[model samples]
Target: MNIIIWNCRGVLKPSFKKRVGDLVQNHNPAILVVMETRVGGDKAREITNLLPFDGAIHTNTIGYAGGLWVLWNTDRVEIALLSKTEQEIHTEVKVRLTNLSWILSAVYASPRNAERQVLWENLMSVADLHNMPWVIAGDFNEPLLSEDKFGGRAVSVNRSLLFKECLDKCNMLDIGFAGPRFTWSNRREVQALIQERIDRFFVNPSWCVMYPNAKITHLTRCHSDHCPVLLEMQPRIQNGRSRPFRF
Candidate 1:
C-alpha cells in the first residue's frame, strides 16, 4: 500500500483537479492526505466528491486558513476516523488484503510556536491512547534539524526542542527519504529564496518492524510550495522477483 501527503495550499485553483489526477496516475496512492486546502463548507464537499477517490473526509477551514482532507480508496483500505482538530486528523487504517491495521495521523501544524506546542501536547496524548503500530506524515512546518533548512535564518535548536521531544516521547522515527533534501521552498528570487525539509513521514518501532522495506520519496513540487511525499509500505517486486537492495 502507498500514501501521499501534500500541502496543496488551496483546492480552488484552476489546476487543482488536474494536479490531483496527475498524482493519482503517477503514484497510485491508496490514500491522499491534503493540508492547507483553504476551502471548506459546501464547496469543499462538492470538490471532494469529484476527486478520484472512493471516499473522503474534510476538516472545515478556519476562515480561509487551514483545512485538511483525507481521501482513500475503500477498495484498498478501510479508514475509521478517531479524532480531529483544525491541525490534525487521526484515523485507524486497515489494509483489505492483508488485514493489517495501524494508526495514521495527518498533520498540518500551525506556523506559530505557541500553537505548535499545543499540537505537540495533543499528539502525545493521542500517542498514549493506543499501542498499535503508528505512522504520521504531513507538513510539520518546523524542521527537526539545523541542516533541514537552507538560505534562511538559521534554525533554532531551542525552538525545535519541543518537536524533537515529542517525537522522542512518542517513539517515532523519521523514516528517511530518497529524493531532494528539502521538501518546501519560498518561490522567490535567488537572493531572497528560503527552503526547508518540513514535510515528512514518522513511524513507531512496531510499524518499522511490520513494513521493513517501507520507502519515502520527496516528489518534485509542482502546484504548491511543498513537495508531495510518497510512502510505499513494501519493496517493489519486478518480474516476480524482489529487486536487489542498495545502500
Candidate 2:
C-alpha cells in the first residue's frame, strides 16, 4: 500500500485543512505521516479526524516548534505502535489480506546539527530493535549529498558525512525519489534562494527483498516550503492508485 510523509509546516492556517483533505483525496494513502505540525495532541487529534483515516497517533508539540502524527486507514492496514518520541513514531504495519508485514518508522530530525547527531543515533537504535523489513522516512533536515541541494550556500560536507555514516551504520539504502529533485525551498530570490532534497525514505536489505520495485515521489505542494513525499511499493507507482502497490 502507498504511504505518505510530509512536513506540513503547520496546520493552523485557514486553508491548511482543505489542502490536507485535497491531498488525502488525491493520494488515498494507507498511512499518512505529518511532521512539524506545530500543534498539541488535542489539536492533532482534531485535525487527523477530518481525514479519511480511522486511527491516529501523535506526539505533542514542544512549545510551538515540533509535532508529529501518524494517521492510518485501519481497515486495510494494521499498525501497532512500538514507540513514540519528540523525534519519531515507530510502528509495525501488517496488510490484512496477505503475509505482508514490516516495520515502518516516521521521523522528523532536529534542525540543529548537534541534536541531529543524537537523532541519527536514535534512528540506528530503532534499526537494532527489529530484524523485519524496515522502512524509515521523513524530513531528516540533512542532505546526503552536495548535489542533493541547489541554490543554497555550499552544502556542509561534514553534516552530510555524519548522516551518511549513520545510514551505513544502520545498513540502510536510500530509496530514491521521482518528480522534483529538490523537495524544499527557502522561497527567497537570487542570492538568498535555497532548495534541498531533505525528505526521503531509507530501507533495509530485507525491504528490497520484500518489495523490489519500491520508490518514492516528491509530490506537489500548495502551502509549505517542503514538498510532500509519497512512498509506493512494488509497482513503480507514480501518483495515487493508478500505479498499484502490493506489500
Candidate 3:
C-alpha cells in the first residue's frame, strides 16, 4: 500500500490543482494526508471534490491559519476520523493489504516553543492510549537535526532535545531520505539562504517491523515550500489466497 503526505499550502489556484492532480495520478497512493489547506467550509468541500480519491475529511482553520485534510481511496481502504485538536487532525484507516489497521496523523505544530511542546505531549498521550501502528507525518515546522537544515544555521538546541524526547516517548522512528536534505526552502534572492527538512514521516516501531521494505519517495516540489513525502510499503500476499500447486 502507498501513503502520501503533502503540505499543499492551499488548493485554491488552478495551477496548484493541476500540480496536485498530476501527483495523484503518478503516485496513486492508497491514503493521502494534506496540511495547510488554508481553506474552510465550502471552499474545503470544493477543493476535496477536485481530488481523485473517493472520500476526504477536512479540518478547517478559523481565519486561514492552520488546516488539514485526508483523502483516501474508499474502495480499498476504510477511514475513520479519530479526533481533532486545535493543532492537529487525526484519523484511523485500515489498509486492504494485511487487513492491518493504521493511524494517519496529520499535524501542523505551532511555531511557539511552549505550544509545540504541549502539542507533542498530547500526541504521545493519544498514541499511548490507542496502542496501534501509526504513521505520524506532516510539517513539524521544526527540524530534528543540524543536518536537516542548510545555510550553516544550527538546529535549535531546545527544540531538538524536545523532539528527540517526544520521539523516544512515542516509540517513533524517523524514516530519513537521501534526496534534498531540506523539504522547505526560502524563496529569496540571497544565494546563501536556502532549505531545511522540517517535514517528516515518523512511524511506530511495529509499523516499521511490519513493512520493512517501506520507503520514502521524494517528489518534485510544485506548489508548496515543502515537497511531498510518499511512504511506499511492499505488497503483502493474503493468507490462503494462493494455491500450493507449482506451475
- Error of model 1, residue 139, in angstroms: 0.5
Please list the C-alpha lDDT of all candidates, in the order they appear.
0.88, 0.83, 0.77
- Which of 1 and 3 is the better model by lDDT? 1
- Choose 2 or 3, whichever is better by TM-score: 2
Writing each residue's lDDT as its tens digit, candidate 3 over 1-247 gives 7778888787775677777777778877888888887787888887778778888887767487777777888888998888876567788888775688878787877667788888889887886777788788888888887877877468888888888888777778765553566788886656767688877788887777777767776777877877998777763432222211110
Model 2 lDDT on a 0 to 1 scale: 0.83
- Order of models, best lDDT first: 1, 2, 3
Q: Could you tell which candidate, 1 or 2, scores higher by TM-score?
A: 1
What is the Å distance of residue 221 in model 2 from its true position? 2.2
Q: Work out candidate 2's RMSD over C-alphas.
A: 4.0
- Runs of candidate 3 exceeding 4 Å displacement: 190-192, 235-247
Instruction: Kindly provide the TM-score of model 2 when superposed on the true structure, using C-alpha atoms.
Output: 0.92
Best by lDDT: 1
- Segments in model 2 whose C-alpha atoms lie over 4 Å from true places: 236-247
Q: Ten-residue segment with the worst summed lDDT in candidate 1? A: 238-247
Candidate 2, 1-247: lDDT as tens digits: 7888889999887877787788788877889898999997677788777777899889877789888888889898999999988888899999886769999888888898887898888887876777888888889998888788887578888888888878876778775667989989998986888899998888888888888777778999668999998877754434442232221
